[model samples]
Target chain A: MTVAPMLSVSGLAVDYQLSSGALFRKHRSLNAVADVSFDIAPGETLGLVGESGSGKTTVGRAVLRRISAAKGTIVFDGEDITRLKGERLRRLRSRMQIVLQDPYTSLNPRMTVADIIAEPLIVHGLASSAEETRVVVAELLERVGLPRDAADRYPHSFSGGQRQRIGIARALALKPSLIVADEPVSALDVSVRAQVVNLMQDLQRDLDISYLFIAHDLAIVRHISHRVAIMYAGRIVEIAPRAAIYNRPIHPYTEALLSAVPIANPKLQRVRRRIVHPGEAVDIANPPSGCRFHPRCPLATERCRNEAPHLLRKAAEHFAACWNRDA
Target chain B: MTSPLLEIDNLHVCFDTRAGTVQALRGVSLSLAPGETLGIVGESGSGKSVTAQAVMGLIDVPGRISEGEVRWQGRPLAGRNADRDARPVWGKEITMVFQNPMTSLNPLMTVGSQISEVIELHLGLSRPAARRRAAELLSSVGISGAERRLDQYPHEFSGGMRQRVMIAMGIACEPKLLIADEPTTALDVTIQAQILELMAELQEKMGLAIVLITHDLGIVAGLCHRVAVMYAGQIVETGLVDAIFENPLHPYTQGLIRSTPGLDAEEERLTAIEGAPPGLLQPPAGCSFLPRCPIGDKGCEAPQAMRIFETGMVACRKAGVPAWSEAL
Candidate 1:
């Protein structure tokens, strides 16, 4: 018998009211995330890759219910929790947590390391006593490769990488089954970034936690995720296994993003061809009608401009939304 | 071959703090020839930015250039004792572009005026001539409708556009050398490729030498002719980009190569460097990377200098050992 996935989101759409316009005039809403859907199997990582204003972060936030979804449903652990409220939402939060992008701003500067790690436990009432919380926090520190004595120090004393580890320890304090790590290593230095990525993988292996890794970096997402969803202008253009996405991307956007990434090997760097999308940055507020990516897509035709393409099955376990998939 | 456009010999920089002296840069030496691109790769606190700042003569108080000399076309830069404060080489000969375009460009000034002002000051052009030149420069850097966009302020332009303006300003006076420090880190992947491509095109057209400082090895492999690997404020390795990527002699360089996740190939586990960077409050008595290096030993407590290897220079004691081989 097969088990159900940990998280399933369908037709997720999010919008934000424009803050600049006059209050008396008509209100305008920015379509941050349009129709989107995906799933994260238990103990697997699903990377959400996109550029700025592509609604990748909005998808993560909407799933967590931090940001209200204008449309769609989010089902977690085989239960429909789209409109979960009050006690139900609070209860579900323990099973889901977020690791923010910047370690410098994500963590509280004044809080001691121990308190920071214990915040989740205290809020969820997971620990029996204060002493129990301390023990758990100590263990958490050790698991993240931090010294046990570091619990007493403040966040300002630590480096960017160490602080990120502290953030991870706090996220794991509740033993959450799902983690939404949003650009966790982007702020870190290259040398220390590997250590944090390794720690996250190790934690997933030992604890069997699922992760929705959202980032702008293609190489990092490819490394950490089992499956990846490519987002463009608030829509998922493609979803496929890691190998398929990297080696045989069907969508033009995925192909462009993959080719744009600089290969580390000098031999390959000289031979690879870079795809230059001859268009300006995508305007999220006033997006193009029909297919959002039509404006910049090199292979876009009149049919592609007049009609929006839905997710179509390409190969085994691979899906792409493109009018010219075969071409 | 022509003489190098800029050369640094035994560059040493330090910062005096209340607790102790921070040895930010230690005996770092590099040379850039005309139209050559040299990449300086290192993590934070590796002194990449300091080397750029030293070249620009922008190292302020508390941070002093303790020793060594920087030569511009075989002539030493104005040392501590100069009559009046006159920096002739800063904007006219050597210019720099910082990482963050949002803060680097003045928000209050229009993008056109910002570029024009540099040209006006450096080239002694009239206001109208400078503005026209600025518009031309904008178009040269790949910005569309450059004339209309020149009048707009920095906030009106996107991140990528603002970086283009920065590059245009850096090369406004036709500087021989440009020090771009993490120039494309803030932009997205697609936009980063565009900016890098634009830089390469400009380099070919104008014969511009660039000192590209970044932590990304992939970028170095893609763009740079030569590579310099910095660790603990010192250059641990230096070679051609191909040599450094293919046969990295220093352990740190090898670790960096293995640690970075490659888009072409997927690995089960990354080879992460174990420990944190050493504190810069005081220079270590031995190899600063000894604690974290995989092949380090007790003998590493003594100082080591760069040794000439077949392909390049390596500063580690057991740099070229075969035992460290076969790991990749």
Candidate 2:
């Protein structure tokens, strides 16, 4: 018997309507994310790795229902929340929380730490009185490794790592089954970044919460994620177990991305042959006819350029979308 | 060693803010040889950028280089008359590429004109000649259809392309030194590789010395010949990149390396430094990293100075001791 996925997204697509200030010009829509799919098991992390404009963040927002999906269905637990509306959507939101990229801007400056964490509890009607909310806030602060006295202080007093911890505490106040953490440690210092990443990992083990860890840093993703998905031009080119994605990436884009990451050791970095993929990511507004990455892919053939490849299983629990997977 | 191209001696920079005087840099010293690449690795508020600014004479009002001498090719470059003396060499000999290319390039001006402006100002070239050189420079940085793209504004370019444009302008006058302050921090990994490759190519072609200031250790290891690890306002360690990575004497450097998640390393819990960097306004008296150092003791309470090691210089009391290696 297989355990059910806590969150499942299928054929997810997000479109942004572009407005040209002309009287009779036709309205244009940019498909930010197209045909993306993934699943996050309870207590598992699905690292979504991509460059800028790859729609990784869009996938996270669409998963959280913060942004309406243009196409596809998002199933939370056993229910299809693709078209969840009104009170039903608000209630479902508590089960799914979002941790934004920049902690400095995510939290309100005027609100105290207790108020920030308690706001979610109060909104969900989980806490009865002010005393109850305070107790829960203190517990959350401790869980995130922040001191209990930190509950009374404002966001301005906390460091970047501490501020991120507060954000995590807020996300956890609702006992969310899944948290869409979009570049959670990108803005933090290197030393502080590790602390936050470790804290997030610790929380996962303790709470059994699933995380859609969206980040551009491949190494950090490898550390925190049980599985990794490589996205390019708003589509997942590869998805596999952590080792497979890093060690035996089938997709050409994945290989290029892995090679591009600079290793800390000079001896290895000097010896490693980097596969520099020429040209930028394809324009999402007007993508290529078949494969969006064909323009820059080194191993692109006539078939790759003419035919769009869907995710095909290459190994157990390893899937790659490439016509020339063997290459 | 080849008559250092840039030398910063006992540099001390401070910022007078409304709250208090923030000691940004305290007795920071470094020397870089001609055509060498030095990577300044430090976190936010570690004075790496301030050191770059001091060398370039770019420190504005409210922030002053209180104590130190900036020497450019054996000539004093920082003092009361530093600005006027350094003005001539600013773009012609020394150029800087900032972190955010979006804000670094003027949005109003066409990229071609922006590049031309630097060439015209420094090289005394005519408008037409500068424009021609600008297109060539753009092409040199790997931008396709450079002439046509040069006519476009900053907004027309992507983040990576804008950075390329910035690089084109930086090398337009064939500067002897280029200081890139977190140049690739804002770029994607692939794009960052492209930029790093471009910088390396430019350095090889122009024989330009580069001071790459960033928080990422990986980039430094790959690109830089030497590395300097800064904490608070001091250079805790400075050495050959290989030695520093292989055997970091300073506890902070060890912690930083261990904390960074290696791409190839197996999934393991990162060993994070417990506390945050001390506040600059009222920094700790002896060692700023004392609060976070794993092997720090009562000896670390006293002031520490850069001590000579087998491979590099480390500013820690227990640097060469057995306890430091045992702790790691």
Candidate 3:
């Protein structure tokens, strides 16, 4: 009787094969993302946050079916989309979209703003005629706060923030239920970045869209995300609601990452004790045994090195993978 | 009273392009005392980096320091032509760390040789002594396996480690002042934290006066003792770190603080500044922030001078003790 979440991904894994180069050479496999599982309800935003090489972007790409998942299922809107191919995958893709990080290169420079936005509609056969496509593009542009006149202009004429708006309009053209935005505002300037973040927040509220927001900037992530998942070395270390993750993170990696973020308030910044990870970052090709964070964890015990810990429910709607979470 | 360690008075920088003369820094000024950290906070094209480059005598080509005085230990090093090489002042007295380590570190040279080059040039030590000192400096910057890692080229090191090597080269001569322009901006938050902590530790031990130029106010809040908010190639506001963050007088400063999402405070909607920064091709005649100022009127039509308050200086016609705080 209960409706399923908008997107549910479980036990997802993505392994990249790096060729050693030469004849008769065995290929090496790198596990970019491993055993990541989360669900986003309708109109919800789930933030995937971690440092570089944390496999956060890999998780986002897997959910969009842009890259093949080595293992696990991606059930989107009650349909198993993991193995979908050809027409089935194309049809399913119309309901899910992606907005990339670099606004400068993401959009086709040759394509007009209207053509870029309407390309989806024409390809998907959502519109019958050119006039219908134009109407849709105009609406989408206006929805993303761009002037309707912008439909005729090229992407080069717009600023970085405006170009990002066009990208949003292109993503919105499909009117998808879910959007996978990877470091959407990281390339932007601080002032312009806030504009895009606010626009995304507004559009999410107006259109009732779900977002798989992947970013390394925790401040912007904290602003827009409803729930947050912390990934480290190809594994999800913790998942919790926004407040719980920010205020009371259980995982050692999450704790260090949060404490690492410098707040804008000098009064608070001066008095805070920063948790500096003493160990080197995890090597994804050869990750540490047991809990991946054990090497850098302040309270890591002997058991933490020998035995891997599963996601244990620490509180209501909070899960963390740590042996000595209490400590 | 002793003069400040470094004092920049009415600094103006311009680049002569084919299109037009780009006035990058217009009367920008700042002062740093010994062992004091001054953060220059601004968005892109706000001339934060140019100010640092000007200090290091690295400004080249069409770019010129039109006006201003850069005094090192109360000695003037400004008002000179672009070719004037202040070689003695550069490495031994003041060193700069740029944003991108990939570009800054020579890919052809090993990390050890790069550090040793600086030590040999500035300290005038023997090759072997410089090599030994390079390893010691690498270890000092918290790079593990420093002895072995030094032989590796820049490509072999990760972004964070390469930046650590860059820091080692920057402090190789025991410089009195270090200007780091967006040093950690390219790295991730965790790595950024590590690099920042290393810089802080180095600053304390060496008593290095740091001019930390960055777009992130959060980093400024955490690291700098004094802060300057730059807009349109000018310092819109300057004050102690606490005064600048707590009661920002200039509207541009207020807008920056408001636009930034607070890591601690969650809000439903972020208050984004309306317009983009003004183009430097034709710098604004009146107040540079006139177009974006929320409280601009007929009074802002004329040029506004820096108004000295009890705590700091703000270049605004209608500026006060952050009265807009409660209004927001």
TM-scores of the models, in the order given: 0.97, 0.97, 0.96
lDDT of each residue in B145-168, candidate 3, tens digit only? 888998999999989988888898
Which residue pairs overlap in candidate 2's backbone?
none
B34-102: candidate 1 lDDT, tens digit per residue = 999999999889999999998888888899989887778877763343213446878988999999999
Task: List each candidate's DockQ score.
Answer: 0.82, 0.83, 0.80
Candidate 2 lDDT by residue in tens digits, A1-327:
188999989999899988867868998899898888888898999999999989999899899889999999999998999999999999999999999889999999999999999998888889998888888898999999999999889999999999999999999999999999999999999989999998998899999999999999999999999999999989999999999899898998999999999989999987889887778878788899788889998778998889988888888899899888652
Ranking of models by DockQ = 2, 1, 3
lDDT of 3: 0.88
Classify candidate 1 by CAPRI docking class: high
Residue range A152-181, candidate 1, lDDT tens digits = 999988999999999999999989999999
* Top DockQ prediction, candidate number: 2
lDDT of 2 at A204: 92
How accurate locally is residue B181 in candidate 3, as Cα lDDT from 0 to 100?
93
DockQ preference between candidates 1 and 2, better one: 2
Ten-residue segment with the worst summed lDDT in candidate 1 chain B?
B78-87
Task: Name model 2 segments beyond 4 Å from true.
Answer: B80-83, B320-328
Score each candidate by Cα lDDT.
0.89, 0.90, 0.88
